[model samples]
Target: MDIGKQIKTLRLGKALTQTGMAEILGVSKSTMSNYERNISTPDPDTLRKIASYFDVTVDYLFNDMTDSPRDIIKEGTAYHPDKALNKDEWNAISYYRRLSDEQKDFIKGQMIQLYQKSSSSNKG
Candidate 1:
């Protein structure tokens, strides 16, 4: 769904009326209505307020993913060592670059099977 639909869904989920949400965001009810109807978009400051009110990331408001904000990390221009993959993991990732198409597919299928088995076992 688009940003407008996501915003409306979040607002309704919180049981907030347009006036209530507008009050929280320091905007007019008509402005909130326009936002929900996709007639206008929220500016950066307003977007930040909305995201904070919903306890979600700015990206969550804009992006298609529903994953938790904690799981999402924004990278800066300079990479941080703590956030970078370890040497072993990087080597394994690089190895995939050398694989043939058939090999890649086989590896992907095997990984999926393994994940499914692990998940099913966890449920039991």
Candidate 2:
């Protein structure tokens, strides 16, 4: 995806309207619409602001690796090229990354408990 598409995808994923994103970024709604439609690109500062607001690196917006935010995970393991992540999965991972450690732990525990409950119920 291009930068515009990336921006649009992120904004839409968060259920934000173009005008809402424009206000958050301190730009005009027309500018935001232009950016999303690829008619024009944001200036450097605006680009930085957009990246920051999305909790993503500028590289994520600028690079062609939109299908995968980063080539390597934080643990230094590289993702296999064949297994490209879709937008929703990427959005989920992005949201998870923004969570605090305690929140992450709680979510993980909940997921584990849910999985165990489901598994036990299936064994009958």
For each candidate, give its TM-score against the true structure.
0.52, 0.70
The whole-model lDDT of each prediction reads 0.77, 0.83
Deviation in angstroms for 41 in model 2? 1.7
TM-score of 2: 0.70
lDDT of 1 by residue, 20-124 (tens): 999999999999999988889999999999987776768877765433222322477654434545445544554775689999999899999999999999999
Candidate topping lDDT: 2
RMSD of 1: 15.4
Tens digits of per-residue lDDT for model 2 on 47-96? 99999998878877867664554444344565565656666777677889
**Segments in model 2 whose C-alpha atoms lie over 4 Å from true places:** 64-76, 112-124
